[model samples]
Target: MHIFLHQFADNAAFNLRRLLCAALLACSVMTGCARYVDKPIDAHASSLLAPLDPQQISADTKAHPSTLLPVLDIDPTGPWNDMQIGLIAVLTNPGLKAARAQGGIAEAQVFAAGLLPDLQIGISADHPDSVGVVNAYGISAGFDIAALLLHSATRAKAKAAAAEVQKNIAWQEWTVANQARLLARRLPFLQQQQALATDAENTAQNLLGLTTQNVDAGNAKLDDLALRRVALLDTTERAHTLARDIETTRLSLNQTLGATPEQRLPFAAKSIARDFSTLDANSLFETARSERLDLRALRDGYQSQQAETRHAILAQYPMPVLTLNRARDTTPIYSKGASVALTLPLWNRNRGAIAVAEATREQLRIEYESRLHETRAEIATQLTELQRIATQSELLRQQLQQMQPEIQALNNAVQRGDVALVTYETARAAHLDKQIAALALAQAAAEGEVTLELTVGVLLWQ
Candidate 1:
């Protein structure tokens, strides 16, 4: 009886220790650890798997039935258009590749959340300093009662967080895809502008040469020669600007397509224009709510926050540490028993964590609401701007058509030397100005439609 009572004291002391220590000990024993391995970084940029050959790829896919493209449920590979470039961008963007790697961590967290808590087993042995005392041995096992009971909340939180990660990745892909499409759309417009600029520059240069000859021969006014020189300088400036624009846009396109800055992929096709008259504002708002990937990702984040709030509330409950102990002390004392340790702090029952979780949930809700509002406002603004551009472009084209007869007559008069050089120069400058303005408006309407597609989370053109 004395042996059992004395052994109880030793075993009780073991059970008094925090389950946290047992947990650490359990982790160290049940799992093996290793030194860190070296992972070398490759600083060199990697090229894409294949060069984008839109025409050839389209032909091959059709000619060979066995060569099928990936079915991502958003197939844009029908006509070798901008959308095809968008698909390639989503598949190959280097930044997106790095973003996708983060998903693995979320998956691992979910796996860990589902795992059961490990059992902690501890053992001790003692040798008597004096000759009379017998050898002593003690063994104890501990389990975390709270972790086992509250596992469902932890798993739900992890699963929701993983879902949020996946949604965020999808959102990134959507943004990258649209960026590639927009760059492709802009490329053709820049090319058209470049041609106009080059033609204007050449025209000015020729006119200035003729004016200089006429002025030296006393056949034209010196003031007329000065005006021609000014016109040449203006056209030259415009040409230089357009050249830079073309080069910069080309570089941007390469970047969007995940190619090196200098690697120009000669695959951009003319972007088909969308009729803004057919687009309904009400319908666009609905589409944005339902299909916007960022909104969906935000919803996932909010749900994860919901799980976190629940878990935080559950954490307030007392956690019981169950311990089973067996021991043999000096002088024939022995013990075998079990114990349940309830840890409850009256001073604070996880109020701080619960408060933090609630506040965070509210912040996320507000962020999502603000983002939705911005999406709706932006969609409406782009639609209105596109309508205005289409209207002005139509009017300008009609006016330019009406002005064509006079321009042709003026050209005929100049050829026969029946008009002042200044008269034709003025007419030419006005004509060029109107033509460039119309082209700019058309480009704006086309690119605005692309922006609208991004805002509404729908493909507006092929």
Candidate 2:
């Protein structure tokens, strides 16, 4: 009877061990089947520099696609303003897209950190050769309590990192948008300068022709005709250079919009904007400390480092594990109990990680301070530039206003033969030069205003 009982117990233990092994094997197989597989590489030229279609780019945005889609249908014969150009850049700039994707990565990490740690299941079996004894089998399951305790801070760090990414993305978008705005804002002024250069070239050519005729007829000095020809050449070169600059500026605008350089981008003909001379620099600096995205990102980074430091400190303590276990033996004995697990801190105490985390926090703190200092300086410099530009633009406007009628009178006198041809031509060229200078100053003032707004992390125009 004793031998039969022992056999029955051995059979029961063996069957239980087999059942547990089979279950574990099936779980492993299912998990292995669900593992990620890499896709085959298709080698080809990347699309980094590909011409972006406004409609397609709009549709690809994660949100607010409708805001940009309609911009494609807007009259291409535009009086398109800074806002329109900024919108296009915000929706299509590749730099901003890359920065935004980083935020997504951080978000995924945050989700991963919030998830519960996987449960660990373990099984073991032993067999004895004695006839009265039988196989022994044990099964246990547990989770790391240290991981559970560290979850809050780890998730906090990930969340902070995600916030930092978002701020960086916002700052990048602002950079792209500001570039497009400045280009669009100044393009019309460049166009006007080109047109004026053309006019000056045309006038010089006509004067050179007239002077050549007079010299051929022995009615004017050859030296005077030579001087006119030289002036014509100079003006022609200036016109060509200005034409090239205008074309380049347009292409730069296209690049900012993430479109082809050959694409014609229409912008408003007027280039002037409201004067920002009265904006208090100190006030803007204060606003920027709170509102600048880059600065905010630094603050977020510091907070994340703080959480990491906390997590590293916690890691210095030993990890505690609690497991529930079941065991059976061929002697007809069965038991169930809870087990505690812990690691001794005699060897590794996470001191290196803690020190690294502390050092990183300090680095972020200094970076934030350095950025704030630089931001203040930028605000001051841009404000001073705005004032100087306002004054310079005003003076140029006055000069232009005073010279226009004088140029007209000189033209009339030259046509009526009341003034010397050389004198009239010189005055006309000087007047055109003044007009170009005034337009350039106006553009400078407009751009200065935009830059000041950008520095302050505020949209003055909007």
Candidate 3:
């Protein structure tokens, strides 16, 4: 009975020890994990600049195809909507792709910069043992606290800069898409003008042929026939030039859409409805000032510089280093020691470095102010120009409407054989010129609207 009791006590003690060891091991693991608990400041700042996950980036890229184009649901102008044409440019433009990639790259840098520097290990050995000399082995491991703090600051700045750059990139891409859409809309009108010119030339040629037949029959003079032929040839040459100009315009539009130089896009033939009125310039200027990406980027840059300056000033203070050492000798000697060390700033007070940081910060401040001023001026200028163009366009439309009656009167006179061929031709040409001018005025008005809208951030490209 006694032996059994003793064995049982022994087993219980062993179990207690085992439990204690397990508890200790668990506590140690927890402590190691807790070492990574970020400070409140770091946590707050890091939260503000969380890196975009791979999945989120992929999703954004995928969503672009649907949203890149603008949808004009009310317009029944066939499959070639404004949105699809805009998408063709946004999806294919290499500049936009590169800008987005640059943003991603910047985001990666921010992630990298957030990480602390790695601890390094150094090892050395020496032996002077010709006849029983001593041998030594030394190892050292250390972490750079300054580097950690500086790197964190650098990462924060980089992140802010990257975000600003991304905004600019997005704005630029949207601007490019807007320009392409405007050009696409203009293509149909240009083609219409070419067709009109061709018809005028054909009409003139028919008149010349009639005059030549009259001369052969001795009913018309040779001089009159020659004059008619010269007029017809001139009209034909003008039509040819107009065709060439249309081709050039088409090539330009194709290039903007990322198509080959020789490639042509088959746009839907439609006329722009002239129902749009002038917008408030003052309101647009205010919106642009508030939303312009370049200005936002400049503001971000200024803030980042301020952070760097603070960090630089903070660096003047030296960090305390703690070192522990242990040594063992084969001759039975042993030693161990721990020491705290700090660098002295007796001669070099870091004044020069501080001055440099202050100067740089001032420069950044000036630059930011300058940028703000420039942005405001540009917005005002663009707004004024838009207003001017809108007014001119309205005037031209009025002129075209007033000229239509005279042109009709001349046409009726020619049909009734009450006017000479040249007089009728000249009147018709003048009317066509007025029509061309009206089309040009309409195009200019549309462009002005697009520019104003874009500047004010009413629309965005993918």
lDDT per model, in order? 0.76, 0.78, 0.63
Model 2 per-residue lDDT tens digits across residues 1-462: 234323544574455556566767768886755568777555333565667654554455434542322333333445567766776688777677777788889888989999989889876666776777767767778988998999999999999988998888888877777788888877888888889999999888878887888888898998998888898898899889878878888888887777777777557734446767668878899999988888998999899999999999998998899898877775848888998888887877898999899999998998899998999999999888878877887887888888888888988998999998767877888888888887787888778777876787767654
Model 3 off-target regions past 4 Å? 1-62, 65-79, 130-134, 200-245, 269-278, 319-371, 460-462
TM-score of each: 0.83, 0.84, 0.71
How much does candidate 1 score in TM-score? 0.83
How far out, in Å, is residue 391 in model 1?
A: 0.6
1-462 in candidate 3: lDDT tens per residue? 223322332342334344446545755785555356556756565543443233332344356552434532322233444445555566556577677788888788778778877654333333333544343333344666677657766777777777777777767777777777777666776777677777778767776887888798898899988887887887788779878877877777666665666654555534344333344556655666677666676677776676677677767777555555544332324455655566677766577777887898798778767866765666566667756666776787787788788778887988899977657766676677667666766666666556655666655222
lDDT of 1 at 459: 67
Task: Please tell me which predicted candidate would have the highest TM-score against the true structure.
Answer: 2
Residue pairs in clash, model 2: none
Off by over 4 Å in 2: 1-21, 25-79, 126-133, 206-234, 329-338
Clashing pairs in 3: 70-83
Better of 2 and 3 by lDDT: 2
Candidate 1 regions exceeding 4 Å error are 1-37, 43-80, 210-227, 413-426
**Residues 303-368, candidate 1, lDDT per residue (tens digit)?**
889989998898888889999998888785878899999867696898999999999999999999
- Sequence-dependent TM-score of model 2: 0.84
